[model samples]
Structures are given as C-alpha cells and as structure tokens.
Target chain A: MKPGPFTYHDPTELADAVALIGAHENARALAGGQSLVPMMNFRYAMPDHLIDLNGVSGLSFIDCGERIRLGAMTRQRDVEFSSDLQHAVPILREALLNVGHRQTRNRGTIGGSICNLDPSAEMPAIMLLHDAELTAQSTRGVRKIPMNKFALGFMTTSLEPDELLTEISFARWGKGHGYGFHEYARRHGDFAICSAGVLIEADSRGEVARIAIVVGGLGATPVRLSAFEAAAKGHRLADELIAEAAAAASRMDALSDAHFSADYRRHLAGVLTRRAMKSAFERIGVAAYV
Target chain B: MSVNGRTYERDVEPRMLLVDFLRQDLDLTGTHAGCEHGVCGACTVLVNGRSLRSCLMFAVQANGASVETIEGLANADGSLSILQECFHDHHGLQCGFCTPGMLMTLTEHLRENATPDEQELRVVLTGNLCRCTGYQAIVEAGLDAARRMRAKKEAAE
Candidate 1:
C-alpha cells in the first residue's frame, strides 16, 4: 500500500514545526513514523500536510534527576537501552521489550505511542503508573497535562489540533521501590490483550507505603486501581491481598473485539495483575506465597 | 543518503516509501517490499546503523542518513558474507521470499550482540515472518554465524 499524496514539511526548529501545525487546518505531526505512516498507507489518516518533527532540534533527549524528563521525539529503542531509565524505571525497559519488535522500536518514539494512545500500548500504561505530566506546546503557549487527564477516549487524546507534545516528565520512584510490568498478546510483538503495571514502595517496617496499579487493554483508557491502591496501603503484599486487587481489576469495564471477548480479556486482566503484583512484591524482598 | 557505501541524490515524492525508492529509483531490487504497512519485515533495512522497516519510512526521511540493504551484505569481492554462508550451510530458506529481510535483521542483531542464545535469536527474529522452514534452520544458522564471527574476532585479536 502507498500513502496518499500530501505536502511535506520538515521543520528543523520546534517553533517552526509548531507554527506549521498551528497554521495548517489538516496537518499531522510525523514523529518516528512507526504508527502515523502505517495509518496513512491504510488511508485511515489522510492529512493534507505532514509536519515532520524528525529534523526539529532539542526534542530527542533524556534528562534524569529528581524527575525524569524525556523529549517527545526520544526513540523507543533509546529508552529501552538507556542506562538512566533502566536504573530509574526498570519496568519501562521491561514493558518496552514487549512493544512491537526490534525493528519497530528502532523508529518508534515515546510521544508517538502516547499520542497514538492504543489501549493496549505499554507506554501509556507505564506513564499512568508514574503519574507523568506531559508538556504540550503550541503557537499560543505551553501547558502541562497530567497523564490521568490526557486520554479522552479510545485512540483519542485531549491534545488540541494545534498543540505539539514537547516533553514528558515524571517523578522517579525511590531507589528501594520495586516495579513490575506484564503483558499478554497473541503474538510476540502484537499489542497486549491485557497488561498490568505495578509500582510499590515499602516503608522501613516492610509494609507497603505507596502503591500504584494500572491495568491496560481492558477499557477505552488505562485504568488506575486507585481504590485498591488506597485500600492496600500500609498493608503487607500478601497473596490474598494481591488476589483481591486482581479481582477488582477483572471487574472493571473492558472492550470486546472480534478476536477476544470482554470476559476473556477480563480473565487475562486478573491473571496478569496477580502475576505483576507478585513480581513486584518479590522484587522488594517480600516473599509472596504461591 | 549513502546506501551500500555509495551516495545517491534524487528528488522523490513525499509519499514514496524508502523501499520503492530503492527498487524503482536506485534499482536495488534485493530489498523486497512485503506488507508495506510495516507488519511484515520484508522491507527491513539499516538506517543510521539501526534496523527499521523501510516501508514505514518515507524516502525523504532518509535524507543525509546511511542505509544498508541486502545488496550490501555480501563481501566486497562478491562472495556471500559469513552469515549468508551459514544460512546456506544450515538451509535457512526454502522459497527464499523472507531471506533478505531475515538476513538483514540478523545482521544487525549479530553486530550488536556478539553472542546471542537460541531464545534471544528467536525473539529477535519475531519481527521478520518466515512461512517456510519453521524457523528452526534459521535459528541454527544464526547460532552458527555467531560462533564463526566470534572466532574470527578472537583470531584477529
């Protein structure tokens, strides 16, 4: 398949790219072209102008400090192999290993995945786990949007037409915190039928001080198990407690498709969540009962 | 872009895929195009030393970048590279439609990872689909190639 005809603009500056998108009525920003180009070839997206962001400067970087900041154009492969990210957020690398294959990851970008907002994508769910704040830029100005409020619906984001996602920043979990991510897909590189991401911080007394659980591929957007997180805090991660959280995850709303039923997805959600929680507990020196 | 050690200059349409540019414009037909929507890795090539699906990228996207295709995998004197020879010894292909893509993918994999286990090779190969040979022979070839390359590097050292 071939993409439909359209004028292409490769702006070398961030402001120029933002101006182009803001000026054009139907212009789409081209990040790594991992997802956008495929959609264009399928005729699902036929933007009249393509604002290529590859040439833009200062948009492909990784800054690690109190909070980790990643440029929108930071390639997924880079993120997967970044030593800083692995040390700060090991679960990101673990989850990225399941995001498509090596070839796709070489060109895919963090911003592209978040903007695409595939319900089964690992990046969005991981972002949700970290409570990331995204920076969006436009001709008007820049604004920060919390990850919880970014996704509007299925494959749709709250991003305005003219806004360009610039950077994503999230506070890093403490050194002793443990994180785990799990995804189940039909094929090795396919999007997950259900995915789970867990981050847990244990207090000096070996009890859960803070926990964030995110279940993806079950609904229009990744759902945070806030109720479970609140209920389970200050408690040890026993097998029964993990099972209860998984049960709550399975009862959440899910979308059914031709290949998978909602009930099947829900079942997978429960199984994956349990496994993820167990792994997280084990990482933090807690012995989860079989 | 510099492709296969040669720099080429041409004006292409914005919609023209890199695979089409290589085949139709430069006549580098060894890089086959399959499932142009990026699912099948038959159009995979090295751009800036990283393996990427050529079909997913526009021709202009390769501006000033270096690309390597199947045509460049052979020795400069026209003999097959050690990896291709390993494929030949292990019978890594049947119909040979996916050979180019598989070879290119494994080429990059072996370059970065001097020694990869069977499971790692199999996982890396998931990007390229091979309907024939059941992937067993391909995996064997990859392992064999890795061994040979390691030996060669040791000898050189």
Candidate 2:
C-alpha cells in the first residue's frame, strides 16, 4: 500500500476533465502514468482525486499542418513510430525513440513526459529546440504556453492544477532534413546524466540560417546557451568554431547529481554538445533549448 | 478492474500497488515484482495496450483501465505463441524470472514490427532487465522470429 486515499474519475470530455481538476485542487490528470504512477506508489505525490485522462480519445494524434500539433496524450511510442512526424519533424521522432525503454515509451505520453519535466529528458530539449508551444486548458479557458516557460524546474512545470495540457505545436520541418538526439546515461534506457539536442536550418542559399542547441537532464529545465548559438549565427559548420561554441555553451549551466558531479556534468555537456552539433550538422548537416 | 481477463471489483486499500494487487489479492503469481521501484521491468504489464511497471502503479490507478499480465499472453487453450516457441528454440531464458515480462513485451513488439532490426530490438526490450544469458539469446530469438515471420508472409503472398 502507498499513501493517501484518492477518488478516481475518468472524464470522457476535455471540458469535464478541466472542470473536475478545477473543482478538486489536489486532483491530477493521468495521461500515461509512467511517472505519476510510480510517484504515487512511493507516496511522493498525494493527489486527493485522480483525474484519469485515458478516456479522452482522439487526443493522441500527430497532425501536420502549419505547425506540428501533437495531442498532449500522445504516447512516446506513438510519436516514435509516427510516419507523419518522421517526414516532418524527424528530430522529434528520433528523440522520442531515445525516451526510456520501449515498454516505458509504449505507455509514456509525450505530454506526460514533459509535464513530469525530468531535467535530463530528451523530449523537452526537442520541444525547446523546435520552439514548440504547449496548449494548456482549464475551466477559465485555454492558454498557449511556450517551451521555455512551460518547464520550470526538476519535476516541475508551469501547468496549474486546474489546467490540463491539450496540445504541443511547433513549426514543421520538411523533408531533406537532418537531425540527431544525443545523451549519456549510465546504461541504455536509464535517465541521462547529461543530454544534448541540436536543430539547425539553412537559408535559400543553403547556408546555415538558424541554430538551436538545447541541453536537458543536466538542469532544472532545458537551457539554451545563447552565447553558443550566437557563435553559429552565420558561419558555416567548422570543427574549431563548433568546439569554441560548445565550450561557451557548457559554461552556462552545470547540473549536479550524486552519480555525476557538477564538474563532470559540465564536461559531459561540452562533449555532448560537440558530438550532437557534429552529427546534427552531418545530418542537415541538422538540429534547440529552454 | 480485472487482470488476465479476470474481474475483481472489491474494495481495496489505496496504498496497495497494482503488482501486489495482482499477485496477492488476485492470486495471479505470474506478475512478479522485481525492484519495487521502476528500475526493473520484471513487473511490467500491458495497462490498456501500453506496457507499464505494475510496481509503480497503485491499484486505484487502474480503476477504469484494463491490464494484461503474463497470464493473458496465451489463448484459453494455454498454448504458447510462435514468439514463445522462438524463445524456447533460441534458449532465450536462463533463470526464467524475466521471461514472463520479456515474452509479453516481445509478443506485442512482433505484432507491430514483424521485421525488427538488432538496434530496434535492443531499444524495444530496454525496459525488461535480465541478469542471465547476456541478452544475446533473447535478442537472437527476436531476430530469428522476425526472419521466420517475414518468410511466412512472403510465402502467403
């Protein structure tokens, strides 16, 4: 047995779910339960009422329009296998594959993953790099939140109790695109001690137009190093320049954990940034942050 | 809520984890709880088609949900699927503790990707932890099954 006794309610409609959350201040919206379930088991989270959102159907589609709109309830496995996502945001699809193991990914939702907001998570870095916008709903109505502001701290997000994440949107990346999502964990499928995600865009001349390098799992939230991005503003991809940029990027934030000390994480940050940027450059030669 | 297609709608303590609920309350001992935390996947189950760690989930969490344990992997006749047959052929299991969870996950995987590569197979079975066989036999079993499965498809076509 765990901690608090809670009432369970599965609302079929979005509005009903929002209303239930609004009414119960301590209620939680359960998406995949990959994180929430374990927390409850450990008595880490004591939600009075559990608002299970599995009944909210059709909320797990990856729609490609002006922006890639991924329903908040979409599972990590769903995103990993999405052909539409593979064609559009290949980086995200690749990143989705990096989330935990296949079994966890099968039941872990993209929204739920971000909502849990583990610092070393790959999805949040992907979202931050793409400048993804999150749609949060409540009894008061809906609000569009940016990636930077969405993730607050370790296992912390800006999402209010009354608000449920409805969708995550980012400008689509077309074909002929290159991408890479890289992270270093103690073992495969374990939480990354340090991770890096890179996204780059080219101009009409095919020169580098945009560069977004995001590092997560090493901070309270995904942190984008502006100094490093500035280094890549207009120059072509070069090794020395990339190394300098990665060093500058690593200087921004160094996370500390028992397994990996702050200095080690800093070293990992720079190394991963270099590798991620190289692979990404090799791929768009390809791909951000919070 | 029911497990392995068996229904039990009695009142239970909120603190009881779904894994314990299945093993102790329901008496379906196939659902083994390894590493009470989420690290080990030995306690994995299909909670509404998605494999999740039962140790991490509370019994109340599955109130409106459907969960499939190792006991539900086979048909009513209790015959093993081809996936299981491949495991046996490849000597995939050693201690046989992680076999139930591994088989459940691999079965679902083959259903989706009949032809999975080595890398794909590795990532797919990442959740289930095994201390025996060094995973070569299990991964070999999955790959071997994929080849046979593809050949069967080609023959049918």
Candidate 3:
C-alpha cells in the first residue's frame, strides 16, 4: 500500500507550521505518523498537503511544574519513561503500556492520539480522567479547550481545520491519591474492548474525599461518571458503593461493534469498573472488600 | 538519512514510506515489508537509536536522522552479529520473514536494557508478529543474545 501523492512541508517554527496548514486546503498536520501514516497507506486519508510537525520547536517538552504540561509532539514512549510523570500520574504509564507496542509508542505522539480521538485510545481516556486542558493554535490565534469539550464524536475532535493542538496540561492529583486504569483486550497491545480509569482521594477518616471515574470504549467518547463521583464523595469506599457505581456504568448507552455486542460491552464496563475501583482503593491503603 | 553508517542524499516522493526508500531506493533489501501498515513490525528499524516502524514513517520524515537497519547489524567481516547468531542457535526463524524486524527490535532493546527478564522480552516482542515460530524460539534467542551482550560488556569493561 502507498499513500496518495501529496506535497510535504516541514516547518521548524510553530508559526510557520500553523500558517502553512491554515493557508492550504485539504492540509493535515503529521505528528508522530504512527496513526496517520497507516491511514495514508490504506488511502483512507489523502490530504493534498502534509504538514510535518517533527521539526517544529517548542512542541516536545514535558514540564512537570505546578501543572503537568506536555507538548503535543511529546512521544508516548517519553511519557511512559518519564519518572516525574510516573510519580505525578502513575495511571498514565499504566494506560500507556496498553496503548501500543514498544515500536509504535516510540513514534506515537500524545497530541496525535488526542486529536485522532479514537474511541478506544488510552491517551484521550487519560486526558478525560485528568480533566486536561488542550491548547490549540492557528493563524487565528490560540485557544484553550477542556478535554471534556474536545471530542465531538468518534475520531472527530472540536478542532478547526487549521488549528493545531500544541500542548496538554492538567493539575496533578494530590500526593498519595489512589489511581487505577484497567482494560480488557484480546491481545496485550490491541485496543481495549472496554477500559476504566479511576482516581480517588481519601479523607483523614479513610473515606473517599473525591473521586473521578471514566469508562472508555463503550461509546463514541469516554463517559465520565460525574454523578457517581459526586455521590461517592465524603463516603467510605464500601463494596456496595463500588457495585452501585459499576451498575451505573453498565447501564450507560454503549456502542455495538461487529465483534462485541452492546450488551457484552455493558457487561465488561461493569466488570472493569469494579476491578478498577478495587485497585484504586487498594492503592490508597484501604482494605477494599474482596 | 544516514543508514548503515553511510550517508545518502536523494530526492524522493513525499509519500514514499521509509521502508520503500530503504528497500527500493537504497537497495537495502534486508528490511522486509510485511504489513505496510503499522500492525506488523517487519519494517522496524532504529531511528536515532530508538526502534520505530519504518512503514509508519515517510522518507521525508527521516531526513537528517541516523537510521540503523538489518544490513548494519552484521560484523565488518560479513559475519552475523551476536543476535543473529543466537537466532540461528535457537532456531528463532522458520521462514525468516520476520527475523530482520525481530533482530532490529531486540538490538535496540538490548542496548537500552542490558538485561531484560523473560516477561519483559515477551512484552517487547508483542510489537513484532512472528507467525512461523510461535515466538518461543524467538524469546529464547532474545534471552541468549542479552546474556551474551552483557558478558561482552563486562569483559570490555
């Protein structure tokens, strides 16, 4: 398979890259090319102009300051190996391990995964869990979009044609926050059939002070269990509460694919949510009910 | 791109894959093209010391990058590298279609991790699909190669 003929532009400056994509019609920015290149080879995507972003400066930094800031072009492998990130957000590394194989992760970019917005992609689900803020730049200027409002539909993002995702930043959970990311896939590197991400902060009394739960691969976008999170806040993490949250996750509308039925996905959502919550609870040194 | 310790300058189509450039343009046929998509890691090579799927990258994208391919894995005397030798010793291949990729992938892996556990090697190999050998022999070859490389490093030190 070969990609269709397209003029390629390698821009070293962010402004130049933004201007080129904005100036050309049917232009697509090439991030790590782990996903887009394969689509190009299959002729599923035939952009008339390919704007390569690898040479662009200031798009590959990992600033673990007050907020965890990641440049759009930051490689998944880099994120997986970042000790700072591992300390700040261990769940990210756990999810990233399942994103793809080592070879793909070496070249795959977080920005690409987020902009592609695959329903089963781990990066988007992690961003959703962290409430990440994405910065988009274009000739028109820059704007910040919350991760919750980033994805419009399956493989579709709220980004304009010319806008490029520059950075993703989010506030880190407090120290000792319990986190768990669980997914069930046929193979190790395969996309998850159903995935769950959970983050919990425990109060002094070993009660749940705050919690965030996001289930992916069940619908067009990751479903955030905000209602469950709110209800469970300030309550002890009991088995019944976890079951209730899992039940709520199972009842959410899920997409049915050829291999997996909606019912099966719903069932998996419940099972994985329970497992993820239990793992999160255990991380907080709480004796979760077995 | 500088490939196999030699730098080559050429003009190519923007959409030409790095694998195609290596095989067709540079005549480096050792890098096989299995699944042209990113799934099969048959076209894996080291770009700037990091293993990446050549099929997933365009030739234009590799400009000014140092690439190490299967052709570069051999000794200067035309003999097999330690990894290839371990592959032969372990029967790591049957049809040999996926050997190049497995070698390149492990070459980088061993360089980074002088000693990798069996589970770690298995996880590292999940990217490259080897349908012929069922991966057991390949895993054994990888372990052997790692042990030999570690010994060599220790001896040199």
What's each prediction's TM-score? 0.99, 0.89, 0.99
When candidate 2 is compared with the true two-chain complex, its DockQ is 0.59
Q: What is the lDDT for A106 in model 3?
A: 96
True contacts kept of 1: 0.89
lDDT score at residue A150, model 3, on the 0-100 scale: 96
Off by more than 4 A, model 3:
none
In Å, residue B49's CA in model 1 sits off its true spot by 0.8
Q: Please give the fraction of native interface contacts (Cα pairs under 8 Å between A and B) kept by each candidate.
A: 0.89, 0.72, 0.87
Residue-level lDDT tens digits of model 2 in B1-157:
8676777786787667888999998888998888777777888888777777788777777886788888887656888766777899999999999987887787778877887899888877888889998899999999998888788789999
Error of 3 at A262 (Å): 0.6
Candidate 3 per-residue C-alpha lDDT over A101-190 given as tens digits, one digit per residue, 9 for 90 to 100? 999999999999999898988999999999999999999999999999998899899999999999999999999999889999999999
* Quality class of the docking in candidate 3, CAPRI style: high
Best-to-worst ranking by DockQ: 3, 1, 2
Off by over 4 Å in 2: A174-177, A204-206, A285-290, B1-17, B47-50, B56-67, B73-80, B145-157
Over the stretch B1-157, how does candidate 1's per-residue lDDT look in tens digits?
9999999999999999999999999999999888888998989999989999999999999999999999999898999999999999999999888899999999999999999999999999999998999999999999999999999999999
Worst 10 residues of 3 chain A by lDDT: A281-290
Q: B25 in model 1: Cα distance from truth in Å?
A: 0.8
Instruction: Please provide, for model 1 over A78-102, each residue's C-alpha lDDT reduced to its tens digit, 9 standing for 90 to 100.
Output: 9999998999889999999999999
